[model samples]
Target chain A: MTADFLLSRYPYVLIAVLFAIGLYGMTVKRNLMKKIIGMTIFQTSIYLFFIQGATKQGATIPVLDPELGPSAELYINPLPQVIVLTAIVVGVAITGVALSLILVLYRRYGTLDEVELLRRMRESA
Target chain B: MTSRFESIFLFVVARAMVPLIQVFAFYVITHGHYSPGGGFQGGVMLAASIILLRISLGEESYDRFPREAGIVIGGFGALAFALLGFASMAFGGNFLEYALAVPGMGAEELRYWGIFFAEVFIGFLVWGALVAIYDALESGGVE
Candidate 1:
């Protein structure tokens, strides 16, 4: 990529790198908590990606402005923003569920390491 | 959740801050249609205030906002949201079509109030659900 293009497109690159890091953490991390943290990072990067798609160079919020004439182009696209907003809540809920499941697992097996947890589950089963 | 070290200063500050945070949350919910804040944002703020209290007061936070209350408030909010949709339906509007539901006000006014109420309901639901999740995590699915 050219230097000027890279400079202008840093946000997309940053989001991609974060998404890769999160994916690596989720897949490669041994600790369950670390995995959850990775999942959070992944979720955040996705949200950021969608938000970036909704951006306009000089557009305002979705709210109607009386001063400006009724032009559709005056506002940023709101659909992605709405979707991301809902996704954020759902992501938090998922995190809560995951953490609780982890808590139960730790209580049962006395371990948070994935391999150990798997071994203990097999033993109990 | 309890730790050995506790700061009386944090406790008092948390106590003083909770009400203000809650009031601001309410403002955010109420002005959501016209402002940057909204139901979900307000609800998160409400949850934050509770979390602040929980961490600051530790065990002492129980009587103030017991664990049972969380799920109840959340359920109530969800129920209210559904009920409002149903209420609009009963009044001959399709689900959530507020302009055609209530008769007295102008159509725009009716829609505005409908949206306002919906925001409030959503705020309550989110606040309660988050608090419940926090409580469950803290106590490990116990009471």
Candidate 2:
């Protein structure tokens, strides 16, 4: 019975697992690059959750079909898709900026390990 | 980096594909109203095509679009978008209120043109900004 419930609600379960993994990577990873990868994974999970929520059984794409009048029920929710699209672009921009900053930091400190970076920060101060 | 990998096959393929990708990007931007793609997605694709050429052709890619032009184009795109918004306001409407942006045009036509122009500006901005970011990163050092 529990297995049946799990299968029926598999999307949420998958989302939860992805979120946990991303969180673990972000918090437990010691390398700065690893943290950036984790951040990307975390963003991926959120995008997946939003896109999944936007899906509906027997619903068509959000594009308007002239044959089938403009009925809200006939189409999947478009707002989430639109929002996620913008979010994806913003996420890319954020990642690009973050990577450039990391590159600068690496140049200055010659290390990408988080603990080492902190030590160097203290030494510099 | 460009000189390190000089393969005729890669060069030919990249050169051939760039134009096709650019054409598709324009199609996506223009047909966005009736399709899944829009300015943002199309703009990214356009940037991707140029980046592909840069990666494959190396220093030669700069001949197509000089490195300095990237940032200038990006700034221009953003300025165009802002000017459009302010133009609407100047015409006695709220910011981005397309209907009031143009005088004496039918409401529907005004809306269509407004959205079309907005998408074009956004496409230009995104394309330029992404290319500039790539150029900045690809160039060694923080200078």
Task: Pick the TM-score winner.
Answer: 2
User: Model 1 scores what on Cα lDDT?
Assistant: 0.90
Kept native contacts, as fractions per model, are 0.55, 0.36
Tell me what TM-score chain A of model 2 achieves. 0.95
Please state the interface RMSD for every predicted structure, separated by commas: 2.5, 1.6
> Candidate 2 lDDT, tens digit per residue, A1-125?
99999999999899888888889989999988888888988998999999999998899999999999899889999999988998998898888898899989998888999999999989998
lDDT (C-alpha) at residue A54 in model 2: 94
Worst 10 residues of 1 chain A by lDDT: A101-110
> Taking the tens digit of each residue's C-alpha lDDT, what string does model 2 give over B4-116?
25888998898799999999999998888788888899889989998898899788888888888877877888899899888888888878887463567898888788888
Instruction: Give the TM-score of each candidate.
Output: 0.94, 0.94
The best candidate by lDDT is 1
RMSD in Å for all candidates: 1.9, 1.6
**Clash pairs detected, candidate 2:** none
lDDT of 2 at B59: 88
